[model samples]
Every structure is written in structure tokens, then in C-alpha cells.
Target: MSFRPVKPLALRTGVRWKIAVAIAAVGALIAVTLSVVVHNAARISMLDNAREVQMERLLFAQRMYETSKPKEPRFGTKINDPALPAQLDQLMRDRRRGTFVQEHRNGGPPDVWAAVPLANGDVLSLHIPFADRSTAIMNDLDRALVIGSVSVVFGGCALGVLIGGQLSRRLRKAAAAAGRVAQGNTDVRVRDAIGGVVRDETDELARAVDALTDALNERIEAERRVTADIAHELRTPVTGLLTAAELLPPGRPTELVRDRAQAMRTLVEDVLEVARLDSASERAELQEIALGEFVERRVRALDPDVVVRVVHDSWVNTDPRRLERILGNLLANAAKHGKPPVEVTVEGRVVRVRDHGPGFPEALLKEGPSRFRTGTSDRAGQGHGLGLTIAAGQARVLGARLTFRNVASAAAPGGVGGAIAVLWLPDHAPTNTGSFPMLRLSN
Candidate 1:
């Protein structure tokens, strides 16, 4: 590929070009204006002085003629001596002949001249020839104007350099801070002292960087606290189970020991699953599946007695493993806290799990799903409270909406309501369908 020079205009949206061009234009205009005014004034003054000199010569010639003595009369007429010719020749030589022509010898238009006889018979001529002095004065003025203009332009350019350098430096610092924030460092900050003006683009960029840094810090701190809580909750049960297994006899009641081991394994698996869903790296492996069939199969696997109702056959794209986990958690929560047999309904991409047992605690329902929060009256067993939390987390990972509420039901013994969990999946596939799902167990 051929390379082309990057235009200064293209580099910065034409701002730099505008500044430089404006400076140059102002300098050129000032220089041209001053030169024209000074040149015209000098030319007019020089011509007026030359005309005055010519008038003085004519007056002197007339005075000499009037004062000179006449020769003796011959043939009854007085003799006359005309001194105008010599005076005229002298005036022409002094004012027009040599230096005047030599000074304007650089091929400019010739100066104008006119000879007129005065009333006293003395010849007076206007010698408005170009003056060497005028030419010299104009040339000096031209030089001075050019020099002054250059000085002003260069000085202005130097000042602009100082200003633009400081501005670009501050912006670069802010850009570096933004890069650090993008790299996940929330503590990075642009030095506000580096910026001079408070209402410029640099200041706005600094403000935006600070706001983004604050938001990222808050989110990271929240995630850290959640991770600590999860670790604290899981360690206790795992330690107890490990200790009990070690204390049990090696050969007695093998079936009972197996049952206890299986329970411990299930708890560990549940904790691991929850951890995986909470991870940022973990993403769903999306695929198109029959929404109604997928929910019906998960419900049947969990409990055959549960009445599964299908109301729609719309297809949805989602990760099958994640969907299974989410549905399993909802069903498990319903069976544990609600009365059997549960009613599972599928309509479109929405799955509703309802039970005939006593409804969830009003305060807990309002507070919403939290880690380790079990229902007030659990029918199947008391939970570790991770069931609802895991379900909600997995639903979020799968880009689905999970909601819990109390629904009125006549099937309950007291005609009260039961807890209802609704999972609504999106109608489209995951954004990155080809990326593998991560099973992250660490915070």
C-alpha cells in the first residue's frame, strides 16, 4: 500500500489549520495596508517639495530680469537680455536630468514635467520628477514593514506553540487515565491541576474519567463483598461434612455413609454451580431450542407428580445447560418451600413454577431473593438459601428475567396463595453464540 502524508487539517478536525491560517492572514493584511499608506504619503510629499523648488527658481529669474540694466538704445529700441533659457536649463538639470532619472532608473514610469511662462515673461515649469530620497524612504518603509510583520508572526506562533503544547499535554494525561480505567484500574485519576480552563474539552474529559472511575470502584467493591460472604457460608458446611465423614467407621453401615457422602457431594456441586454463574468470564453457550419442550423435560426430571402445562410452542435460543440449571433451581425451590404437586406452565418463552403450599413470607417476598434466605415454611427441607439466588444469577447469565411473587390459589388448604417463580427468556440467541461457557468457582 502506498502512504500519503497526513494533513494537519485531518489530524485535528481542521482546528490547527484554522488557527495558523488566521494568524497568517491577519499579518499579511496589516503589512499590505501599512505599506500602501506609507508609500502613497511619501510620494505625495516629495512631489510637493519639488514643485515648491521650481516656483522659487521662477521668482528669482523674474527678479533678475526686472533688475538688470538695459543696453544703450539702438535703432530707437532698447536691447533685451532674456535670462529664462539659462534658468530653465539650470532648473531642468538640477531637478530632472541626472539623479532624478538615475534614482527612478529601475524601470518605473517616468515622472511628469510641464513648463509654463509666467505673466512677467519669466518661464516657470513644474518639475515633479521622481526623487531619490522618496524612493529610498519607501524602500526603507517596505523593509521595516516586512521585518515588523515577520517578528509579529513568529512571536504569535511561539505563543501559540506554548499554549497548544500545554493543552495537548493535559489532554494526553487525561487520555492515559482513561486507558488505565479501561484496563480495570478504577483508582486512576487525571490531574485537574494540569488543566487551566474549567469549561474546555480537557476539563470535560477529566470529569467523565472521574465519574467512570467512581462507578467502576463501586461495582468492584460490591462484588468483593459478595465473594467474601459466599466463601464464609460455604466453608462451614463443607468443613463439618468432611469432619463427620472422617469420624465415621470405615466398614459399618456402608449404605448410610454413602447417603451422607452423596448429600455432601450435592451441596458442593450446588455451591460450585452458583460460583460459576456469578463469574464474569462464565457465558452461556446459546443454541436454538423448543422453549416449551425444554422446560417440560426439566420439570418432569425433577418431579413426575408435578403437573406440567404447555401453553406455547415458540422456539428460543439459549444455552441448554444454563437453562436446565435455572429451571432445576426454581423447581427445587418450589418443592422445598411449596406444597406438592407443583404446577409448571410454559407459555411462549416464559416458564412459571407455582405450588399449593403456604405462600412465601410477605417481608421476604418484598425483600426479594438473597443468598441463604429460606422460606418461612419449607415442606421438603430447609434450604441453604442459594437456590433462589442461583436461579436468579443463572437467569441473568442466560439473558433471562426471573421474578418471584405470591399468586392467589384455591388449591391451598386455607384458600391462600402460593409462591410463584417466573422465568422469562429472550426470543433471540446470545450475542456471542460461539464462545464456550465458563465454570468459574472462584470469586
Candidate 2:
């Protein structure tokens, strides 16, 4: 009844976020560097211009004193009586200077002070306060640089996010296509399905996945053909052998021959069925059936001693024949390979069969059911390993999922982990629109 929430593709982390952050960082560095260079150059140019204007006024004031000989002469348009600082006046009086310019605080405010001697030996001095015109120009430049740098940083970050989203969406699409292919849906051709117009690395990756899935589909098809042919070819001979064994006299040798012949026939049939399932040739006949009663009947028919527990009562639409085959194989596997007290629990749409055995092999859990991976544990040359393979195949055809895991056996003294085979079926018939959740990993 409950399903885990699937995680969505992320733009805040992984390759997307990394790419965005890297690009933004480089842009921000460039912006800061340019702002610093431009700010310094503008400050130097403004201050230099201010110093030149101050010097021109000082020269004009000296000319005014020589021509008019006024008591107090206004130097230039912006200059009042050019007052000399004490240091510059002393330098002029000592005759230790010609036309000169210097920058100092000089007990007042920071300014650029210039002194020029008059024809009448009067030293007219000029001072440009550092905080007046030049400081205002520098402050305006500072604000503009700050704003420009911030704009560049924000613009770069936004562009990075946009580009990151585009790239991440492409990659996520390809990844999702590959996931479906891995889950046995080999029809996924990523390049053809979601390939972009402009070719890039993402397109290259999608093409690679397309090639891989195509190759796998061809190989699987070839294998399926071989399996089906061999199974069909063996069916007749195996039937003849069985008939011949039955014609023989009643004895141990005759019984052994008949039993082996029957097993070979069953193996051939299972192989053919698997081939059919692989080729998508099998179809399910769905009907609403009582879940509790149907499972109890199947469990009793297979092994009366096996325990059956019905936790929920519900009707499900599924093929009864295929369902029986799946349940039968699971019960047979537990009987042959697992310890005693096999238990079947039907909860919701899931039927779990637990056996008190040494559990499934690690390889089996990692790699689902394979062809002939039967291990020699308790019995020598007992199981052919096709039971789970066939069960899993049938489960797939029925729009169900079959999973096997190992469960703890704490109550059983001296007992180890036990094997648990789970068969999950959809509650209703699959729609033509899309697929239902087929499988879930057991916790």
C-alpha cells in the first residue's frame, strides 16, 4: 500500500552545480580584477587633472600680482587669494625652491600645495584639498565599480544555473533510458528517443547507450532463438524415450530411465517457456480471484506441511495458471533447498515464501536468476537452477516481480539465515497508458 518517494534530478548538486559554481567563480574573479584596475586608473587620472588645474591658477595669480599689484588679487575663477602653508612660505623665503608642487597633510587637511615666486619676491601659494573635487570623483567611481562588479557576478551565476539545468536534463533523460534498458526493456534507444538537434557530449553519450542496447537486444534475441529451437527439437526425442521406458518391464533401471526422461522433458518445456517469455510471446489471462483462498489452495496442493498465513483479504486480476506455476516453483525450491517449516504470507498484493535454510547465495542476490547456477550445498546434483529462472520469467510476463533475499533465523536454535522469495503483483490490470510499479527491494 505504501511506496517510497522517487528522487528527482537535482540542479543544486552533482555535475550541474559543480559546473555552474566553477563558471561563476571564474567570472567573479575577472569582474573583481577589472573593477580594481579601472578604479585605480580613474582615481589617478582625476587627481592628476586636479593638480594641473591648481598649478595653472597659481601661475595666473603670479601674473596678476606682477601686472595689477593689487592688495589682494583673486587668483583664478575658482581660486581665492592663494594662501601658502607655513612650510611652503619658508621654502620661498629661504630661496631654496623654484616652481614646485608637493602633497602633505601639513597640520590641516590633506592637499596638493604648489608655490611660485612673484617678480616682487612675493610667494603666491596654491593648495587643492584632497577631499574636494578629486575625492568626490573617486567616490563616484568606487560606487560604479562596486555596482558593475556585483551585476557581473549575479549575471554569471544566473547564466551558469540556466546552462546547468539544460545539461542536467539531457543527462537525466539518457540515464533514465539506460535504467529501463537495464530492467529488461531493450527497446530503449536513447539517441532516437531524446536526441538533441545540436550534437554535443550528451548526444554522444546517448548514441553510445543506443548502440549498447541494440547490441544487447540482438544477442538476447539470438540466444532466445537457440534456446527455443533446442527445446522444441528435444521434446520429440524425450517423448520417445519416455514411451520406450514405459514399455520396459517393471524394474529399478526402467524406473530410473523414465524418471530421467520425464525430468529432461520438463527441462525442455521450461526452457521453451522461458524463450517464449523472452520473446514477449506469452500473454496473461486476467480475472478477479480471491487471494486468500487461492494461495491457501496452491500451498496445500504443493506441500500440505508448508505453513500458509493470510494477512489481508483482497481480489486481484491475474492469470491463475501462471500464478500457480510461479507459486509452485517457489515452494518446490524451498522444499528442495531450504530447511523445514516453510512459511507463506500473503500481505496486500505481495506473497512471501520464507524457508529456514542457509539463505540464497550472495551471487544469486546480486545477480538475479541465471540459467545453471545451482550450488552444491545439501544435495549432490539435485537442482538444475531453472526453477527460479522460470519463476522470474513468468512473474515478468504476468506484470509482477519476483525477488529473493535471505532473512535472519534467530528463533531456530543453531539455525542460520533463511531464504525468502517475494512475488509482488499489481492490484489491478495494467493500463495501455503506462506501467505500474513492478518491483521493490525488501528491507
Candidate 3:
């Protein structure tokens, strides 16, 4: 299974924003379609009404023309009316009954003209104003349509944004839960059991994640139990072997057997300890201690030839036994794989172990410790590779952090220079340098 890294700022271009853009685009399309259809229909209706009104006015002018009443309030005869539309004039000149409407360029009402060719070759014509009221109503309708279309598009975009936010939030929760699971916190869950017919994709995702986590947790537990059981089974046999080896007469061969038996017992014990750490079966016994003084004593126990330095003293609350184990493993690693003049430094609440040698393997620093798969033999000590792993686990139990790096970060292929291991205590630091000098010999 693969997982993507979290990008906090991705929300700007994530699913929600895409959904909003899609919704706005669709709304704009619909509004434009509606606008075009309505506008055409309205324009056709207005033109039909204009033709009807102009046809009636043409009939009225025909009656006035027949009477030849020049003084009456009726249609005017135009020998030449320049304002008459060319189409209308040509139609009348052909002695056909027709009308024409001309729209004003300045967006006012149109001019409706009725013209008829008289028997005496005079054109009796009258102009009827296309009502300003009708044009105003059309203009208002257009404005309303524009405002409505804009409103709908914006409203849809807002709705899309809202829905997208809800979906992304749920997805982020699921991703965070998966991240926690990847980090070995199997208890983390995206949400409760998802069900019901109305469930969405997010619900399905959450449910799937929960299922996967449960399966993974079960598998991990089964493996841990098996390892623990094997270690328990080996303990009695290994003890018996140790007793038998000790009974042999003192000689080089007897010494070899004893050493091998002891090594087997230690390996078994280390496996059991690792299993306990994995299952979180071990708990820290916290107690405040003077850090500088504590470090000096542990290093002295390991070998008085080593050196201990106290830059600044500190008081911290942590499990003494576990702290000793952690320091022991670090010192032991240095003794085995690293070179001497091994120096332990105590500064404030932090402790550091340094060894001048070929340095830690590049792989160890990069990928961290893994059981039974130690680094290259040339660069690593001969062991089951559980030393650093147990140290790391114990540090976690004590709520401290153990970090490893090359002394000058100059470790390359085949190893180069020295290595430094830093242990940072979580709790406290008291402003006390203590009775020890800045540099103290382990003796």
C-alpha cells in the first residue's frame, strides 16, 4: 500500500475548488442559453405587434386619402418624405399596401411608418410612435434577466464551495487516521462505523481504513506473540546449557562453550525485551535524578578508562533502570564497533555519547535500527542487531528521544570518521553544575 504526503495548502486547488468552478461554468451556460431563447421570443413578439398596429394605421390613412381633405386632421401627403424607410417607400411606389418599422440608433422607441401610393401619384403617409412604455418594459426585462443569471451562477458556486469543504474535511480526517496507522498507532480511527443507505464515498473510505487498520493490528500482534513465545521457550533450555557449560573443567575449549552459551542466553533475553517493548508491556518508573552525576556513574561502571564530561548539570524525571539500559547499550555499541576514548557528555537535560572510529554505517543513520538485519559486517558489530532497537524502544518508554548521526556527518561509503548519539530527556533541567568539573575522568 502506498500513501501520499500531506500538503496543507492543497485545498486551494483541491476537489472543492474544482467543483465550484464546474458549477459556475454550468450555471453560466444555462443562464446564457435561457437569455438567448427569451430575448429572441420577446423580440419576435414586439415586431409582430408593431406590424399589426402599423397595418391598422395604414388603413386609416387610406380613408383620409380618399376624401382628399387637405384641411382635416388626417394623414399628410408627402411628395417626398426623406425619413420614410427605403423599403416602405419602394413598396408604396409599387402601389402595394405595407408598413415598416425603424428602430432608433440611440435605443429609444422605434418609428412605425404607414404609407400608401394615391391615385394622383401622391404618397399619403403617417408616422405612429412605437410606444416608449413598451421599450422601457423590454429594457427592464433584460436587466432583470441579467441580474438573475449572475445571481444563480454565484449562488451555485457558493453551494459547490460549501459541499466541497465538507467532503475535503472528512477526507483529511481519514488521511490523518491513515497517517497515524502508518506510524504504528493502530488505535487511531477516522470515524465510527459507517452505514445506512445514504452513505457517501467518504463514509466508505473511513470504513475501509478502519477495516485495514484492524487487520494490520491483528497481524502485528500475532507476530509479536510468536516471538515472545519462542523466547520464553528458549529461556529454560539456555539456562540448562549455561549450567552444563559451567560444570566443564576450566580450559580454552570450556571457555569457548561458556561464552557461546552466554551469548545465546543474552540473545534470547534481548528478543523477549524487544517483544515487551513492541507490545508496550513495559512501563517507566519515573524519578528525578541529577543527570550529570548519573551519567558519570554509568560510564564509570562500564569501564573507568572511558571519559565523562559535564558541560551543564540538570535534574530530570525518568526511569533509572531504563536509563541505565539505554546508556549501557550505547556504551556497549561504542566498545564493540566504535573506537576508544569514548566520551559521554552531559549538557543540561541532554546526554551525548561519542566514539571516534569509522563512524556508524550510512544505512544505520538513514533507515534506523532493524532487528536481525544489522548494517554491513565491516562497519557493524557482530550481534543480532537488537541493541539500538532496544535502546530506541526504552527511550520511547521513558518519553525521551534517542538520535544517531555521524560526528561530522561525514559518513560515506565504507564509513568515515566518528559517530554521535544524543539522548534528550523530556522533563526537567535544574540550574546546577554540581561538584564535578566541566570534564571528568571516568575513574
Clashes of each: 0, 0, 0
- Residue 428, candidate 1: how far off, in angstroms? 1.8
Say which prediction, candidate 1 or candidate 2, comes out ahead on TM-score: 2
| True lDDT of residue 41, candidate 1 | 82
- Can you write out model 2's per-residue Cα lDDT over 131-238, one digit (the tens) per residue? 566666777888988888888877887888888878888888888888888888787778766666767888888888888778878999999899899899999999
lDDT of each: 0.66, 0.78, 0.80
lDDT of 3 by residue, 1-443 (tens): 99998877644478888888899889999998998899879977887788787778666756765776573435444544678788978897788867787878897777777777777776766676777877787888899889989998999899889887777766776787788777666777766522234569888778888887888788989999999999999999999999999999999999999999999999999999999999966667667799899989988987897889999998877778889999999988888888887999999989999888777777888877778866776656688889999999888777788999986543544446677899998863211221211334596
| Alpha-carbon TM-score of each model against the true structure | 0.44, 0.80, 0.74
Lowest summed-lDDT stretch of 10 residues in model 3?
A: 428-437
* lDDT (10s digit) by residue, model 1, range 191-233: 5534565467778768876986787677866775576567557
Candidate 3: give the clashing pairs.
none
**Candidate 2 wrongly placed segments (more than 4 Å):** 1-12, 61-110, 113-126, 195-198, 375-381, 409-416, 430-443
Candidate 2 vs candidate 3, lDDT winner:
3
**Pairs that clash in candidate 1:** none
How far off is residue 78 in model 2, in Å?
19
